[model samples]
Target: MVLTRSASRAAKCIFKWLPNEILHLVATELAPTDLAVLCRASRLLKNIASPLLYYSVELSTSSSLISFARSICQSVDASLPNSARLLEVAKFTDKKPPISPRIVKEINDALCRLIRLEVLILLQRSIDYTYLLEHGQFPQLVVFQYLVPSHALPALTSFLNRHKNITDLGFISPDSLKFSTPLSLPNLQSFMGSFAFLSTLDLTDVSLTHLTLLLYPPDIAVSHAVLVNLHEMKMLSTVEVMGMHANERAILHVIAGHLPHVQELVFHHFTSTSSPISPNESVNIAASLETLGELRSIDFGGVGGNVIEDRHMVAQWSAACKSLTSVILDERQWDFKENDWVVSWNL
Candidate 1:
């Protein structure tokens, strides 16, 4: 009982400054052995303890996330923070292949049960609920974590659909991670993830204001709808786009049309199979954006010389973008015959 009193005191002290009320728990109840008693040290240190106890009954085979998670469900703490369970579980576990169906279902059920939970990080995990028509909702989800999956797309989609109060969204799944559902995150402002099929993600139509799009050896034709609603949006602040192609030139044309209002633009891993744009090539990139006037900054990466005729096009774009405060280009474009690398802008 002495340990119980100590555990109670520890919980109170740990939460002494926190604005949230600390629900008192018995020391003996929170600790079944000396290791648990020793863990009653500090609040931050307690996260490790909480996930360990909340998810696992036997803390021995913790290297296996599955085993640890199985044990956590048996933890005795009634005050276990439900919102933190996902990350906490992630903290002390290792991933193994040939994913366990039962564990996946259990994690999904736990996530569903946390009606008030607003954050989740289910990396390299499978939480499938094929029969769950409950429409389990998370109206306040602010963050999500999904690594890569062979087929975890449905699990990710279900989580997103249930949450109407989301401000952030993310996913990582198998190649061509495409879904037919229209993503409507009214409050969402930031997102990052990989998609095998860019056609499925209509970001420009969505409310997202900040975005980072990346996937290995990118195929950019997937951005059809997002590229379509280019000029209508006034809230887009930052865009880091990759995998340039003939179609991407169209996307850039639309953005260039609105250049004066943009804060930042970055182009990465751009490779075009077609020959460089000519005077009559008909891809009027800078000409289309004459209305935008200027930009704050522009950065280009991995632009190969073989794909283009002259690097001076960068200078022309900078000249046209009257408000361009900063422009960056790669040093790889320098000629060996002339030590002169070049920039014409005043900035």
Candidate 2:
């Protein structure tokens, strides 16, 4: 059924008169495209909805990046209060080529005007962001994710040192192994990066609560260093180990000693045959778990049946930790209810 022009106008008028809180609630549910269209209804609506529309800006092509940068630069009041809080710069594989130098310059210039930007995600590896980092463009950044090359590590380190307010950081720096110094991040609570980077961090002053480590094999020394660093972080409550290799029983022991306060643990073990863990190694893992008295939840994957089904392993793990609240094996989960483990295999 199509509405008459008068009826549409009446409905819009009614919507415009709704309470500000209700309107904001409604706006939160709208997609970015819908929110942009809604901003055209009235000046009041535009003022109320522009922030939501521009909260997260993703430029997937050089054209969009250059166009948006030009548009924002042309505006007399480029430093708008409702500037985008999150900005993502990346080239789509199926779309245009990588961002050109001119587009990169525009993006940096636009970032300077985004005074309230909180998160900056850079997936473009070729772009030089040293200028943006040196300039106080993203003064309010709390979360930063970047793909760093070896040459850019020094600049990235400098940026991280200056941004003490950053609470979450994710990096993919395969070439860079160590920083010049232990850059202090007093407010950092979550970190996601390679095991090499994690091992090099001096987190003595940082109170990290969540950590995600990307593991690699044949790096026993690096794994030991990572565990040593984890031992210093007494506030950690959650830990995730991805690409976990076999024969890391000693590493598991170190984890139990270091992350005593960790309540949740997830392990995505490597299934390659080259680093197969023995039954003895599984026993060591069970022994390590017994030491983690505060552990309430644990998830395991890709580890052999010897570790998962061993009677001593399960019995000791279940007996030593009275706080066992949830256990996830393979794709199934078990929750403790009435002092008995209840399976939820379907989930």
Candidate 3:
């Protein structure tokens, strides 16, 4: 209480002397709680503090999410004073007496008013809030991610078409392989989602630079459509793949074949049966790396049973790919230093 009062008094004392630009800068540095208190100090302060208070919001529980929704709904005409640009909800938990329809409507209404939102991440799988997306059109929204409902692909497709400004997107759900529509995002630059999801999109015209694929057993068999898209991405430079069911060597080969110009490669969470790659396999992998003339860094941090720290293996890769500068294996980093591989423990 004392600290809050002191902050309020300090803000009031400075408001009279400081310029509005200075006040805006100060408000940006204040925590959300302090910003809320500043809003109550005076009308001038409220105007300055309200925007920062709502600029970036992160809700982690049902109660807080409901309160935030209600607060926005109760604002002037349930619209003004909204300047939220980034909103990330951890999840909507399942407790007895679930969220009511009234609450949902309020959330939907409040979301519609946040026209300036740029990044929206709904990390909840329990509630399919995908419907709320249908009610709002965020003109500045560029990045959107949510747990998609298996039946909401049409709605998702429609949303993407309306928001052509979106460049980065991700949505994981059961039966994602059902998506067959030829979706297009001319502005898309980076995407992170299931491999099955990537195969369904028509992105041959898009110049993607970063790609992250979530793999499963079924995704091991790379589709022709996926290969076509990969081949078409002339600007792609970074790639990250995570899965346990696929062969690491085969995955590397495919990447080398289509993305010979890739600069950074990461193979995460792959549980390989071969622990320390056999001499023959190491030779073969190095031989494949030779094709990627632009490859600068390769990481296999969480690949189970894979020993990427072997100096001999690192040396082979460095020899095969002269551009290789950094290698990460099992939390250890090896950098090509002065004609030798230098080891750095990341763990």
Candidate 4:
């Protein structure tokens, strides 16, 4: 299936006439290796692929990080703004001493040149990036995820306050910020962090509308505290509870009590149990759902129980909540059978 020289020339001629938009679309689907090769094909291909090639980069080694920083500094020297929009560093060892101050400075300098950077993810344990915030770098950043030490909280809070554009944030080790007063993020719309950290936050002034809590069968008192604090967020409309725990009923009641306006709910329970839902728990859950007048969707994952026997229970819930449009239990969807008013599960 080898092409002759004339045939190859004809193919190139046809491809050369393709629209730039089509070429950009095709380039986006190419693997990094393929993209590198494509960039060498012609000036137009190189121009189209350059931005995509450098758009999002992950560095896993100190040498690679240093090299990338040097390259970005070179781009700055040439008066060219970096094309990077997302940058991730995944290999910082938490137990080891921090990266050399010199390297950190160099990395900071490189990051400053990225005028369009919108997301930065530091998968390491703790790395101080206060310099970026202090210098007003990443002015367009809208999402940020990082793990930092307790001493970094002030700088982090300052950063959040300065960057009013940030709407989504994840603090992998939120314990660091627990002792500090809740930092107001008027524009923050979604938050992902530990249940303990989220429970203690004073979100009275924040505009949080979505919350994702990572839980591990939190202490009853802690869970109660979280729910009480969450009640203050009157605008919250979506909640996701994810963890391997057996307190589903308690969690659901808390959510229903605190976030009455929640329109979407997702439960990812990884705990395995053969026990069926207790009658009291079912009653409580139904009562809570009844209070969630705006509830529309519920997505359940890793849920196991007597689903067949509980069909009637689900039906009662559907009947009570006229606004409910869809209910997903594990991998099955429950639809109300109009003929008998029974809930039927479908794949």
* TM-score top scorer: 3
**Residue 25 Cα positional deviation in candidate 3, in Å, after optimal superposition:** 1.5
**Tens-digit per-residue lDDT, 1-347, candidate 3:** 00112244445576665667878888889999999899899977887888788889988788878878877878773334347899988765536357777776777677777888899888765545655667678889899887777766777777887888888887666543547687788888888888788876668578789888777667767643475567756689999886655354457877787778799999876453425456787688898899999999998774333344377788888899999999887567888877778776657
**Per-candidate TM-score against the hidden true structure:** 0.59, 0.79, 0.86, 0.74
Q: Candidate 4's residue-wise lDDT over 71-107, tens digit each?
A: 7787533533457888888864334456788778888
lDDT: which is higher, 1 or 2? 2
Worst 10 residues of 1 by lDDT: 1-10
lDDT for each candidate structure: 0.49, 0.70, 0.75, 0.69
Measured on C-alpha atoms, candidate 3 has an lDDT of 0.75
lDDT by residue for model 2 (249-292), tens: 35567678767888888876665442434557656766788878
Compute the lDDT for candidate 4. Answer: 0.69
Worst lDDT run of 10 residues, candidate 4, spans 1-10
Clashing pairs in 3: none
Better of 2 and 3 by TM-score: 3
Q: lDDT (0-100) at residue 134 of candidate 2?
A: 67
